[model samples]
Target: MSWYNTSARQLPWRDPGTDPWAILVCEVMSQQTPIARVLPAWEEWMARWPDPTALAEASPAHVIIAWGTLGYPRRALRLQECAGVVVEKWDGTLPRSREDLLSLPGIGPYTADAIIAFAYRERTTVLDVNVRRVLARIYGEAAPPTSLKAWEVERASHLVPDDGEAASQWNAAIMELGALICTARNPRCEQCPIAPHCAWLKLGKPEAATPRKVQAFEGTHRQARGKVMRVLRTAHAPIGVEELRERSGLPEVRFEPALTTLLADGLAAATPGGIQLPIE
Candidate 1:
């Protein structure tokens, strides 16, 4: 907590008065996307839709277009769905309990726990990949990163401070530590706050027994999907199939599967003339 007070990044989402909805947006946008990009989009999103009710009332195409180049366009659709639930079911007030938050579209264990801890001021564990790595390196003899046995929630639940304030700070601190110093590649051990007691350091930092594999992003369905979403984001009207193909830089390839996926995910819509983002 002391380290966090002195070193935490000055982010809009960390503002003392940031509301639950904004926090939820930040968490969702930050998933598999850099905070640098998430920041601008979040600001615009909040400016346009200050609450769940506003977001729920917006057109899906507007939301997707506003989501911009954040890659996973489906997250925008899910976020909109989540907003609708919050507005319709919870009256625009985000749930205070983990179970209810988890019941919302796109809300999962980690997100639910974060809402509980950060927004609700309850003692709860937040276990992102960074937190996972930090914990695995710290109390590792008992639970190494390699040991594929148990669950993160169960393990992380035990480490949080009993008090709400300290617990939230601890969650943020550990995650920041991992992201800034204890990085996946070339950790800055000297700058680490807990370096003196880090088990990985003591053990000379052995390589992973089975290294994690990196998935290809380029030349994959994800790339094609992103391409399609990008086209829709910039279009003023529904784009024809041929136009979509030409704009997508894949004129020879048929994107029927991608279009179907976009429709199913509620990220796009079909029109008589062409395909477009969902109508309001």
Candidate 2:
């Protein structure tokens, strides 16, 4: 906590006056995306849609365009869907309960806990990849499991402070510690405040029995989809499907499935003229 108080990054959403909606946006944008990349995008997004009402009313085309290079464009649409639900069902106010938050689109366990802890300042185990790694090392595991376990959740829950404010700070501090010091690769243990207490250090830092798998991006269908979406996002008007595919510069095999999935996912639409981003 002491280290976090002085060394935590000055993220805009961490500001004292930031509201729950802004925190929700930050959490969504930060998922699988680096904080550096998310920072500018998040700022522009919040400025464009400061509240649920604003986001709910935003056009799908505008939302996808504003989402820019954030790899998982579907999350952007899900966020808009969440905002719509918040507006229509909750009177434009984010719900305080975990169950209620989980009911919102794109929100899962980690996000729900985060909103509870960071937004509402509640006592909840807010587990993310960083926090999970930090806890795994502290307890002598070389790495966290491929998927979260019941035991992990129970252990993390027990570690939370009883008081809401203290618990929130603990959650933030531990997550920051993991992000900055106890990183997944080449951890800076010498400067870590919890280095003295970390069990993995005492155990000689054994490697994980199974190394994590890294997915390849080049030439993947996902990459092709991104290329297609980029063209559609920048287009002022619909373009013919074949023209759009040629413009994407993807081979026919990659382009066909990419376009099919984009249209199926509702990320793009086929208009009377041609294909473009969803205007609705």
**TM-scores of all predicted structures:** 0.94, 0.99
Q: Which candidate number maximizes TM-score?
A: 2
Give the per-residue lDDT digits (tens) of candidate 2, residues 103-144: 999999999999999999989999899999999999999999
Cα lDDT of all candidates, in order? 0.84, 0.95
- Backbone clash count, each prediction separately: 0, 0
Collision count of model 2: 0
Candidate 1 minimal-lDDT segment of 10 residues: 140-149
**Residue 125, candidate 2: C-alpha displacement in angstroms:** 0.2
Worst 10 residues of 2 by lDDT: 10-19
Q: For model 1, what is the error of residue 241's alpha carbon versus the real structure, in angstroms, after optimal superposition?
A: 1.0
Pairs with backbone N, CA or C atoms under 3 Å apart (clashes), candidate 2: none
